[model samples]
Target: MASNQASNNTQQESKFTLSMNHDMEQQQICLDHQQVEEKEFDYSKRSQWLRAAVLGANDGLVSTASLMMGIGAVKKDIKVMILTGFAGLVAGACSMAIGEFVSVYSQLDIEVAQMKRDNKRSNKIKGNNEDEKNVLPNPAQAAAASALAFSVGAIVPLLAASFIRDYKVRIGAVVAAVTIALMVFGWLGAVLGKAPAIKSSARVLFGGWLAMAITYGLTKLIGSSGL
Candidate 1:
């Protein structure tokens, strides 16, 4: 009987040990799941920085190329063309950085304000206990998007300048490239923003074409006026 009791005791101890091990395994699984969930949603700072850098480079390329091309169309010497391109590169980059910051800040401000207004409005309609949470964009995501957009917009022209030999060709290429990039970028932005891509693309293209027409018309005027 004592032997039988000892055997039962050993069996109970084994079962307890197994139960504890099972609980620990379950806890480990939960921890792993939580870690994955965090990773899936997290947008790293490096990603935003990289995006901003690319955008800046693209903008520098496109803007400098367009400016150089336009000036070259006026038959400016290489020295003058190079000077103008350099100036454009600096100015465009600064503009891109400032523009990105302002645009992002404004967007965020408006979003927050709108959310507050919405909450107030909802409260009036459905009472304070309706559990209406304000859904705002992830700050990191917004920063990444804005930085990437502006940097790319600026860098494209700068890179194009390296390939363009003549000022006029550079300008024309810059204009064409910028227009195309704007449309593509606009469409992408719209899609990301949950807007209709076709409408966004059309709007972006129209604006780009309009600007090009004006620039071209001005170039003609400069040529005709012998300026």
Candidate 2:
């Protein structure tokens, strides 16, 4: 009778040990899943900033380069080209900054209003107001980021054309520089956004080329017509 009792106790202890192990394993799995979900959410949140920055840079590069090319079409002076590019860089940066600020401020206002309405609907539904507020966009930060990105991109063409004194060589240098920058920007945006690299690069390159061509052609036509 004592032997049987001892065996029964052993069996129960073994079962209890196995149960504890299973619970631990299940908890580990749950933790891993939660971590993965959080990582994905963080990545999605960061994508918005990446998209805005890439857009700002591309706009700055294309618009500034086009302006320089247009001016180069009319005037062969390197000084003139450089000056036009500098002016474009400053103006474009300011424009991008202001536009981003206004847009983001509007979005912030809307989000704040929505949050207020949601809070009024159900106190229990408000899980964490601090977390929600932390995720909200800052207009000033957006504006600064846009302005800095635009300035960085606009500098590319200015540096490329600065040293080349010959009109033809300067034009070629500007084109080459702009092409490379466009490809880099597109590839970067694609990689970050998980889009097709080839399509993104091709689209950006083609758009840049089109803008420069149109600007150059129009300016040349106008100058030639003495208008």
TM-score of each: 0.48, 0.85
Model 1 spans with C-alpha error above 4 angstroms: 44-50, 69-76, 111-227
Candidate 2 lDDT over 1-227, as tens digits, reads: 99999999999999999999999999999999999999899779879889888999999999999999999999999999999999999999999999999999999999999999888887734458877999899999999999999998999999999999988999999999999999999999998888899999999999999999999999999999999
Best by lDDT: 2
TM-score of candidate 2 against the unseen true structure: 0.85
Task: Assess the local accuracy of residue 137 in candidate 1 as a C-alpha lDDT between 0 and 100.
Answer: 36
- Ten residues in sequence with the least summed lDDT for candidate 1: 128-137
Give lDDT tens digits, candidate 1, residues 22-92.
99999999999999877654535344444455445445544555565566666557667667777776666
Candidate 1 TM-score versus the reference: 0.48
Alpha-carbon local distance difference test for all models: 0.63, 0.95
Total backbone collisions, model 2: 0
